[model samples]
Target chain A: MSASPNQATDSDRSEVTAGIAAVLHPAARGAAREVPDAPPRGRTAWSLLGLSGIGFGLLAVSIVVSVRIGTSGVSYGDLGRSLGSRLGVAEPLPRLLDSLIWDLRVPRVLMAAVVGALLAVCGAVLQAVTRNALADPYLLGVSHGASTGAVLVVVLAIGAGSLGVTGGAFVGALVSFGLLMLLLRRSGLDSVRVVLTGVVVGQLFAAVTSLVLMASGDADATRAITYWLLGSMASARWGVVIVCAIVAALGLAVVWWYSAALDAFSFGADTAASLGINVRRTRIMLLVVTALLTSVAVASVGAIGFVGLIVPHGVRFLVGPLHRALLPFAALAGAVFLVWTDALARVSFAPQEVPVGVFTALIGVPLFLFVLRRRGEL
Target chain B: MRITVEDLSWAVSGTGILCDIDANVTSGETVGLIGPNGSGKSSLLRCIAGLRAPTSGAIRYETSDIHGWSARQIAQYVAFVEQALDSDSDLRVADVVALGRTPFRDRWRGLSHTDRAIIDAALAQVGLADLRSRGWKTLSGGERQRAHIARALAQQPWGIVLDEPTNHLDVRHQLELMRLLTDTDQTVLIALHDLSLAARFCDRLLLLHRGTLVATGPPEDVLTPDRLRDVFEVDAEIGQDSLGHLTVAYRGTA
Candidate 1:
């Protein structure tokens, strides 16, 4: 079989050589000189800026529309008045409507956007670092680790009185990420090994979470654990929203700063290193940032799936794969996507809210399939 | 810049890939590295490019030891082109070539006008100026090879190290690429399998066998029939063509 292929290539080589020789001949020079004109310079930059502007515009619209959606019959006018009153620019809204928007709806919508942006950026960075399109925060099992900690607090009441489920989840995420780093260090930080180790470690943490929940005899605690696992923004508070938003912003900044290096990585680690990038240091740093962002997000709102897996892929189709353009657009599109998903979670069934994670998967699975089909990968 | 490899050796796992390899590449010289497959040509190039650290000995660029220099610092003076160029991105040809400026530009800054000019000149040199906007995935195999050469040219380095750069090119492109390298004043160390092309274009040839330097000299001295049989396992007749270019005709495996 190898000999036949070699014979075929030998024949092909002669034909190709003849063709190339013809191209190099003086008679063909004029024709070759008449080649296609260069594409207009700065076109990519203009398109990226234009697309980013559209993304931000869509995000603004999504926020406004999502905030107006709920069980209450509060009008946009009332929500505006409430926001204006808080900013000291208008008359105070009716006490009921003001507290409803100020204390509950606004923070929930903001947290949803922040978490979405964080997950999407993490997904982009992880995909670049690992050179695997399937990579995401969940791929590393940080969410499962966070779930284990949350379950321990919610079901077993371990640390519930002090650190609480949120605090416990954060710690769990850090521990899992730390363990992953240690294992990867020993395994030479190959992407495949990192992914495989994550799967094993993630499964172990998830089993522990289930074991804790099963051991708890309290039916109420079991129900709470199940609800949290499916994920929701219903428990979002101002403090959680503020902390998550800050962390997400910082993560975005760090990822954006490394966008060029990320573009080099799309070729592969060796190629990136050949381009003078410090591949080992850059990969480790990106892993740390993505893990941190994922931990903070999962801690705030249970393990929300799909946003991290699908958002970067979706954004890449629209703006191509350069990270400088992909990162910002992914963040904006992700923010808008989750805000609407959270809105659907609130109103899809009316009164009895479904977990926002369910809605994201409902939307994400079809979108992912569509993208794969379009790319001809499926 | 002159690159001096003094008693250099590299090992992978427990086995040596390169052993006590000594060679000197003076500025403005084109040196051909010729050997059978697995003779450590690529490994030697990687070490010189600072993509790999030698297990022992030293590589010096002019007066400075390259091992102590950062990858970025080394890249500013030396550009490397590996045999394989695989990119999963949809970046355009110009964008790929502009990546050569990575060592010079700030991480956050866009390419300046001078960078753009250098990229255009490099593209023109490789006759790919027309394809600057073409997607990298859309290029033919020969065109892709030229684009990579263009990228190395855009680096504007004092020295270049290429591993099997002509592997996929047609005969015309292979000759043209060698001519381009010979025309330049920069120091070059190119790994090649085509002995005739090496003999024609290189100022010096370094032959390796089993991780050791077997010969290093002008083509006439390095391409002797005895050495070819012993190192490459090929029985061949060597002579000069009408244009005074050295030619090799192989009869059979040794």
Candidate 2:
């Protein structure tokens, strides 16, 4: 029927309304189809879990081994005795070696692991939210912002009375993130725009940092700024380690909670929205969480480059692209990687410790290139 | 489910995209949304699916206004598939289909036995059971489209809304997809560029012309030569095939 103006009247309405009653039921057509003889859980889950277990094992070994291999070179027996005494399971070692392992190396190594885990998780989440493979906290200007805040304190002595480098870095990271959020809110958080904004903001802050250091003309202040800029766990204390550990754990828990939604995002925003995800709210929440994680890591030990950028990609190659597996695996891999890299930095140049960031870039650039080449992902 | 659109209009920055569109898709009816490019067919589908809000109209799913429902609530009844899904993800095909179960799944819970059965059935229905473990990037264009259909099927929704589902499909797959949609008991609202397929498969057609509803009725009523020439700007001869399906023969652009 043509559904002319007259025919669209009340008589046809009754017939159309009659059809509504049977409409809302689920289709019964596919229920009787023979399901293939596949395992319900599949091998992928078990394999990923096994790989994650291996990653954690490597992290533990890295921490224990790296703790012993530092410049002081405590023997394995002394290391065991030192750990045993700390746990109150055995007789204590001599005062010097005990303090060296329990006091210095243990916390430093632990901080490296925490920072690595934080940065890597942050990178993974950011990459998912922005839908950019290359996204990382450092590349997005979050780390540079923390550097600006830390440098502002060290050079200008703005927070000399109360806020130290860590406090300054935290505030700087938030402020920079606040600016990024503002820009995103205004311009609608497109992936390319976010990366472009981060790059521009990072360069602007870097220039200001340079100008301040050049104008101050103070060698000691410049040295301190340079060391912090290149990132180090040299100043790692028990307090910083504890705080970072808490932040990293909390951040990981939150990211894990949204891991399913994050997987939806890999399909793009429109598809994510169709999957009943509140795309805008989820993106904002994940971005803020990532910024907070990046800030905590940077504030505690400056900005360690490439862990965030490279760890997720490396882990993705191992576990595929599911965020549920990628996030945790990346965290474990990052922890193990940074612990060894910090150890190498300590011994690579002997008396003068090279910045861990330098080693990270040196190793990370090559590894990243290799991964890209292997995946054929430009 | 029955979808009743009452004076639905969508505008962007004061520019109209869909203007005063009114239509009714009855229960289990496969309604084709036919329009040329930029004529607002996709926008109307988005609004109906609750992915976009209409500027000043109401879309009722059954007796409830979908505008006031949460995205999850709306998704429980209506599933929308986009024309082309562009993703760089390396997820396996099974994982991609598992995303359809998201609206039913809790944040902490993994797929249950029932969910797995439904997902498997959907994959089988789409002829992708053998390729469930294949990487998403490895699938051909037609396979990708079928995978998306399988995803919608996994949702177990009461109604399925699709935007240009046949855009990338070859002729065989395109016909297969339309056949599948017509065979389903679920109410379907699909936007299509291929008029002959729409004429053959759709029970009813809503013809949109430059952001307005130009015509609405059964295929034979809506696919007339005058209506095709007016809305699609094409001269077409229409006839009934041996199976009583309406066939359109396009001569040239008007």
Candidate 1, residues A224-310: lDDT per residue as tens digits? 777887889998989889999888888899989888889877667666777778888888888899999999999888889899889
For candidate 2, what is the total of clashing residue pairs? Answer: 0
lDDT of candidate 1 over B122-240, digit per residue (tens)? 78777888898898888987778878777787776667899988887889988888877776666899999999999999999999899999999999999999999999999999998
lDDT of each: 0.83, 0.83
Candidate 2 regions off by >4 Å?
Answer: A1-31, A36-42, A160-163, B240-244
User: For every model shown, what is its TM-score relative to the native structure?
Assistant: 0.90, 0.93
lDDT, residue A145, model 1: 92
Worst window of 10 by summed lDDT in candidate 2 chain B: B68-77
List per-candidate RMSD values in Å.
8.9, 5.6
lDDT (Cα, tens digit) per residue for candidate 2, span A1-378 = 112112122334334323422221245344434664345576757777788778878888898889887777888888889878879998999898788888889899999999999998999998888888888877668777887888789877876632399999998889988888887788777678878988888887788788888888889889988888889998888988998899889999999989889998877877788888888788778888888888888888888889999999998888888887888888998998899899999998888899999999999999999888877786
